[model samples]
Target: MSIPSKEFTGRHMLMTTVAFFTVVIGVNVTMALYASSSWSGLVVENTYVASQEFNRKAAEAKTMAASGVVGKLSFLHGAIHYDIRNRDGSPAAVDEVAANFKRPVGDHEDFHVAFAKVSEGRFEATHRLTSGDWIVEIVSRRDGKVVMHEADRIDTGGSGQ
Candidate 1:
């Protein structure tokens, strides 16, 4: 049997070291790219319209608030209202407000889902509406906190308040 030369053994060791360094450098670069692309905290700020620069977003909050809608729409300045009603233009229950918005707006059919609750003689839903046409449907609250549910929706269109 023939034995390999010391030179051959030394060259193999050198190649192995190079391969290890290459892999380590590749992994470090990949990690840096991933870290830069992905953020770990809140991506947007939720401010009331009083501090907004865009007039459109502030207006949308008022329109939805008139209907007693709730959900995250597009918050502009913070003047929200709700004007929810029934098919016969009457009041609905807390579990029947499903607002389907299909207007001259986005390319896709974006909707606003609402669930009303009685506060005095008025009704309030769980969908914050924008300044558009929405067919709100009411839903019931389960064994979860309302805060865990839809707290509010923002109006990303115009400022009405």
Candidate 2:
């Protein structure tokens, strides 16, 4: 005697469709939660306030760029180093140097490092950043006024060196 097989029916079809949609919807919800929790997507807290200062900040940036002050940054031995020069290739005279390190898409690893003068036009900060991509903002100040402001993107290789 042969065992009989059950025939496929509309109830089976309906259950299959429901199961497929449930899995799809569940995966989409999980992905959405992960994306939302990962990054806040906030560039500036107040757009209106930022807009009000846009022109002045732009003018200052233009002036800073026109001054031809250049900064070279490097990571060595788990330390941050910055070298600054003027248009004439001589050391730029600034009283203080500070750096803001930020992740490309998140703020969890963001930090501020105050650099000390190691030598003429040279500043050093003993901060070991994790090996990854970073956005660096270097600000040099003279007599309580910002003299040079530079932004650069850098990758700390696998060794974080």
Clashes of each: 48, 0
Q: Can you write out model 1's per-residue Cα lDDT over 25-65, one digit (the tens) per residue?
A: 99999999997677432222455543565576456545545
- Summarize candidate 2's per-residue lDDT along 1-161 as a digit string, tens digits: 99999989999999999999999999999999998888644477799999999999899889988999999998888888899999999998989999999987779899999999998799999987998878888999989999898888888867776
Which one is best on lDDT? 2
Best by TM-score: 2
Q: Which stretches of candidate 2 lie over 4 Å from their true place?
A: 1-42
RMSD of each: 14.8, 6.7
Candidate 1 versus truth, CA RMSD in Å, comes to: 14.8
Cα displacement (Å) at residue 12, model 2: 22
lDDT of prediction 2? 0.89
Off by over 4 Å in 1: 4-10, 43-161
